[model samples]
Target: MGEKLLMKGNEVIAEAAIRAGCRHYFGYPITPQTELMHYMAKKMPKVGGVFLQAESEVSAINMVYGAASTGKRVLTSSSSPGISLKQEGISYASGAQLPAVIVNIMRGGPGLGGIQPSQSDYFQATKGGGHGDYHMIVLAPSSVQELYELTVDAFNLADKYRILTMILGDGILGQMMEVVNFRDEEKIETYDKSWAANGHKNEREHNTITSIHIDPAVLEQWNIGYQKKYQLITESEQRYELYNCDDAEIILVAYGSVARICKGAIKEAAAQGIKLGLIRPITLWPFPVKGIEKIIDIPKAFLTVEMSSGQMLEDVRLAVDGRKPVYFTGRMGGMIPTVKNIMDKVMEIKERHS
Candidate 1:
């Protein structure tokens, strides 16, 4: 336990990663998330860590790959367009089964979109951003406090699972200020790297960290092994926050900054005698689909609010399994959707149900 201090979500995430034992950071400058890299530059040196501003996002992610292969804790961060540039390295890290953390302070984008917050990367983050038969452990933070906590958890989970882990946030969540409680600096656990590629001089034989498999049979075996790890993650890592769900006849499904707006809307709807509740996901990849399935019988309608066009709505539909009607409302290109706007959609859905 520790005292709370007001901090922006991006700064808190960088500080939290340091506390989680991250010693190397490589990233390019990008709007909304630039503060994160700046913070790391100043603080990492003081803590005997390395922070490098790469020439491009592609170079930054490859730097992450190099550092992570050394079994050292490493990270990279960017906005949407920058993230797209890192996809190749990201896929390489996945194939190599390297443990590393990546942060995306999402901005609107099919290409070079606006700097404002948006959840348009939902599909990219959850469905494997790069070309590959793989998935990263994607965690979404809705508040500054959760940003800190999840950043630490992201590192731990990445190390434990030996895979890439992402902290998926939007511009609003990245820039917002809130009080955050940080773990004691001395109490953070140092990762044990019995499997890391440190050095093989004094050990048995040399261990090479790579993804290239020349033999087809060996590649097939590796794929199966990786799939097994992913299955374990799916079963054990689903996380969500439920509010006022016990007797609600309608549910709101959302994540990231959109969830905060939906929270207020749910409260107002409750006051107006509307049986509305909220299901906010913390882990987007292992998405709490089972938890949602358990409550599907209670809600006649489920409304999904997102900053993207309609990415997360697809997950809601899959979770609902056609048991109830699912509706969607979205605002694109870096615009924030308001509580009133979401509530209006909720009201419309309620009326249609009646």
Candidate 2:
């Protein structure tokens, strides 16, 4: 264990990134997540790391690509629209197989959406937001402490898989404050960065990092390799928590802030003699299919709680696969569904099934 400190979500996430040995940060200012950059700006230089504010999100992500090309732990962040601008660079990084971490503090969006927190980016994050036959290992943190722990995990996973990793937070989680315990974990893992473009100095074969393969056959082989890597990750990396699910008649499927609220709703439902539970995904890309599969007694119904228009509900639907009923309730444009709102939704599900 490490010392506990009171901190904001964004602040703790930045601190954890440093502990993960990330020495390069490139990002633009966006509300709800700007504080993360501010913290990095103040601390990176103090710790001999580099903190650079790029002219734009596109430039920022490309800078991440450059840093990672040297086999350095690198990171960047942005909100929804900014992340959209970064898609091309993210795809480039994927094509080049560069290991980097990206933080997306989501806000409502299709274009320049509202500054309010939202989970509407669920599809974009879980699916390939950028063009490519690739995926990022996406981690979602519901608490400030998770922001710390998972940010550390994100770095490790990115390096291990030699792929992009993302920490998906929302405006609520980014701006909220909580107690965080930072432990200096003794890392025993090693990554082979033989593909890095670090100068060979004529000591070995020239190493080049690129995604451009003109030969269709070569590109097809590369895609196949990526698919193998993804399969291994999916089998090993699905993470979720099942709270009081053994005999649950109804369960709430959520992640990030929405999951936090569902925890309370579970307690409320229990008091009303409703067997309610929660399945909170810590990794959105892998999507915890196995955890969803192991659900005992098959809860009568599952409700997806989100800050978007039922985006994650689609995954919940897919995982349930007609064995159980799946329902959804959400808020958008910065509105958050209250605990009462969530509890009410649970009651409605119970009543319908009753």
Candidate 3:
């Protein structure tokens, strides 16, 4: 621990990326998450880093792809609609196997719906946001502190696997202020980027980086390699936090800030002699199936709470796989589900099961 500072989640993300050795940032302005770009603009030049405010989200992500190809740590961020625009470039990055960190501070959306917090992009982030048999490591941070910690982890994971990593947050976590402890002497890990297209001088062969494959057979092999990498990541990187799950009767499933709210619900339910537990998934893509598996025979049912219309409910259903009944309660278009809302659903499930 070096120093503690009171900062908003967006600012923490910007600072953490800097500390994690990121030197290139490319992004456009968008609501709720604009502060992250603003912070980068103010800090990057001072640290001898590159921060370019591109003309559009599409331009920014392509810039990121260019920077990443050079074996440099790079980052980009946007909200829902802006992230949508970057999907093509993200897909391109995935195809090329370039490493970069992308941040999505979610707001209500199907089409520029509103500038309020939302987890509606759960499916978009966890499932392939871009396209073509690919997945980015998706991390859902529940607080300003985690926004700092996970932003660093995002860059590390991206480099470690030579793939894209996504920090999936929402407007609340982006705007909310909290005290964050910065690591002064944390060792930033490095990887072999000999595969990067950063020029080999006259010593070795010049490295070439590209995502284009004209032949179907070559593309099929590329897809197979990507799936194998994804499987390895799935086996090694599933992360989650379980609260009071050992003796839980009704387990609550959630991620990001929604999971924070579920904790409150759990406490309230406990006071009323109801045993409620929560499973907070830190990595949305891997989905923490192992964590759920450990207590599969314990909990009678599951209640998945979200700020979207049951987007993550699909994953929970697959994880449970009919061994236990799963239920859902959510609010869309930026309405957050309150603790009372969660408890109400919990009580309803208890009644049905009883």
Candidate 1: 10-residue stretch with minimal lDDT: 183-192
lDDT at 170, model 2: 97
Q: What would the TM-scores of all predictions be? A: 0.97, 0.97, 0.99
Task: Encode model 2's per-residue lDDT on 110-129: one tens digit a residue.
Answer: 78889989988888888989
lDDT of 1 by residue, 78-181 (tens): 99999999999999999999999999999987788889999999999999889878999999998899999899899889988999999999999889999997
Clashes of each: 0, 0, 0
Write model 3 residue lDDT over 1-354, tens digit each, in one string.
499999999999999999999989999999999999999999999999999999999999999989999999999999999999999999999999999999999999899899999999988888998878899999999999999889999998999999999999999999999999888865689999999887788889988888888999999999999999999999999999999998899999999999999999999999999999989999998789998898898889999999999999999999999999999999989999999999889888999988
- Model 2's alpha-carbon lDDT is 0.89
Compute the lDDT for candidate 1: 0.90
Off by over 4 Å in 3: none
Best by TM-score: 3
Rank list by lDDT: 3, 1, 2
Assess the local accuracy of residue 115 in candidate 2 as a C-alpha lDDT between 0 and 100: 91
Candidate 2 Cα outliers beyond 4 Å, as residue runs: 185-188
Q: For each candidate, what is the lDDT?
A: 0.90, 0.89, 0.93
- Record all residue pairs in model 1 with backbone atoms less than 3 Å apart, i.e. clashing: none
